[model samples]
Target: MEAPTVTALQTLKALVALQEIDVRIRDLEKDRQQIPARMKEIDKLLEEKHHELSEEKNQLAEVELARRMLESDLKAEKEKIKKWEARLNEIKSNRDYQALSREIEAARKANLGIEDEILRKMQDIEDLKTSVSQKEEDLNESEKSLLEERTELKKKLDSLNADIAKEESTRAESLGQIDRRWLAQYDSIRKRRDGVAVVPVLDEHCQGCYMGIPPQQYNTVLRGEQIVTCPFCHRILYYAKSLEEMSEDKA
Candidate 1:
């Protein structure tokens, strides 16, 4: 079979517009895929905040329990001190009185320690409660922002989908007008070259690989005499006219 002529190869350039549309569709689909992951990331963040708040609450409860226990101990010590003083009146022996006096002093020291502990625990619980309150507020704000972001992304994704569908329909119609054999060759080359099988000739250079063409190849391309593949990259090549040149040619 004769190698396809350069005029015939030029027809493949029509596919470039189709490729642009397909690229846009792929990009939109990529954006759509990220939407769910982004939402999931927000959900994960919220769950982390909730877990942190729960831990803070538990710490507060523990501190409060400690404070209550200390309070109970202090009250018991005060009651014992009152009982000891009342018994002092009935004590006749000096040794018994001295021993009761010592016991009262020890009870007083124990009461002081318990009161100090209660104070420390109360402070800790207060601090923890404040922290938990702040975290809850932050979590609420973050969730609200995430929800708003999700809504906006959904609207944008829907718009992109609509655009893609319209472009795809147009691309299909354009593809129908192309020759079957040429389309097959285009598809075959595109598959091998990552969706770029056709490239423009600019300034005696192959845009596909930025390689300079020999004089012989350049003349052939200018004449539109025979199809030429880039010697380095093997892509189908064609010339692209500037808008002014195209208009002049039409006149």
Candidate 2:
């Protein structure tokens, strides 16, 4: 016994359906591949925010430490001025007394300059405190927004995975219906031609490559009795009919 013959139109229809499934899978897989990259981007953003916060806190600590050291120095300078004033009361020579008075005046001026610097440091500390507070708030808001975005991306990835699995099952069934010879040729062409193995002949042109078909080949495709390929692009070509014509034919 011999196997029954499969018509060209039947194979073409099967291939068309298979193509639709394959394209859907391709798109779903593409989307699935992007999820990891997007997640990585979110992680990078969070890391940068954390680093900025850490840096600000470190700088604030350093400034506070410097302010404490300045305060200690001021205390030491005040003690020295007190001791020098006590010595002035005990001085007896006029020239020695005059030199001591000028020294006291210079020390007072230096103390005033130190006081001004301490005030600036205090202001700087306050400004840094304000900045740290704002950044903390911003980080909190970013975490909330990114968490929502991550949740949405995970949902999308799960949905895409489910869709891809379902389409693959359908493709398996479609493959079973197609003749092995046709499937092999279709797969080969698809691999060589950017995932488009089958195309419709529309207006005497290959819809896949948009290349014009010769008149004789176009006529042959219209007969729909045998497999035909576009001469220019080597894609399997099917004659496309309007819905009305297809309905009339069915009628």
Candidate 3:
């Protein structure tokens, strides 16, 4: 095969360099997109923690309300027992006295049950208070840690965004090295083939699609006299062995 002219070789080199920038720019943009998603993931965790803290606080309030109600009921029952006992001297008959005694006994039993329940409720309130305190502490720590993480993530997102912008600026500059026709061609193929417009041929195989190129076409591609598009993938093919060295950043 005949050797490529100097100008064609230069064009090929520019194309390679442009492709390099495109690859980097794409990767940086991908990073740009993922950082926000990560932030949202952390935000979700923070929201769940806040919900847990609120639930514990509400539960404590409920337990306290129950304890107060139980106390009020127990006080009412004790007052009734005292008033009924004071009427014992006014009984008219033995039958009436026994009835009054039974009534006092029933009231005392009820008071005892209420007292036990009140004690149990008081203990429950204490346990609930402890739970609320512990939960508040945990929530505060989580908030602090999450805020720190968010700040760090924000920094990362800013850096990735800046890098993406830098790469995009470089891509625009690299476009100046090629003609409008070549740029349009590269853009078209890149859009259709997952941002890959150019590729190398190794062992007569188009690396883009891993399909074998016809021998004659492969030979012409090696000559590099003109831009060659692969038959299967329709991407520009390069032969690194004959032209300039391939970018070490390949892949």
Candidate 4:
């Protein structure tokens, strides 16, 4: 609770400032690490879409092949009917001619049925082609949008890298401003306390743990004199106003 030397107050300020930078660095690094996983998810989605499209096209191809085969069978049936018709004039008996005419009639009926089926198959092929076309268009649009999103993530990753580098470039100077004893203590506490070695006292509560501090300790922190730690959390403390003042001075 005693008055703090100007040097001690400055050291406290330096620790607070350094904590801000370290927290930012940790967050940015975490976000940077997640970009690859996100990109992989995007790629997987695209792959699934492509597989669906390929299956549709394959079905369309199969249907078209079936239609062609039907047409070929119809042609063969008509040729057989034509050859049987040509034998009618050469037949001498009535029964023979009647039998040959019945054969031609049956062949014509079969060709008619084949023609109907071919028409239906053609319609199915057309429907499938339309569906595949629509799917391809949708897939292209999705790819464009996802690729844009991926590009934006890349830009964000680059921006975070730059910000981290800028903050780190100044970290050494902040470290130099602190008393070596306090700096050593801050590093030790940060490791043990989840990277939060310095916290602000707000309304007589330790921001780190949200636990109430002793009134005397709160008053000591309010004066911005001497480094204090929360009794419950044992993390170093500073008055919130002191940090604001330091920030304003820099601005």
Per-residue lDDT of model 3, residues 158-200, tens digit only: 8988888888888888776776677788899999999999898
Taking every candidate in turn, the Cα RMSD to the unseen true structure, in Å, is: 4.1, 3.1, 4.6, 4.3
* Ranking of candidates on lDDT, top first: 2, 4, 3, 1
* Model 2, position 194: C-alpha lDDT score: 82
Worst lDDT window (10 residues) for model 4? 1-10
TM-score of each: 0.78, 0.86, 0.86, 0.77
lDDT per residue (tens digit) for residues 43-156 in model 2:
899999999999999999998998998899999999999999999999999999999999999998998988998999999999999999999999999999998999999999
lDDT of 4 by residue, 207-249 (tens): 9999999999898888876779889988889887876787798
- Scored by Cα lDDT, where does model 3 land? 0.83
Q: Residue 68: error of model 3 in Å? A: 1.4
| Residue pairs with backbone overlap in model 4 | none
Cα misplacement distance, residue 95 of candidate 3 (Å): 3.0
Worst 10-residue lDDT window for candidate 2 reads: 240-249
Measured with C-alpha atoms, the lDDT of residue 242 in candidate 4 is 72
Is 1 or 2 the stronger prediction by TM-score?
2
Q: After superposition, how far is residue 103 of candidate 4 from its true place, in Å?
A: 4.1
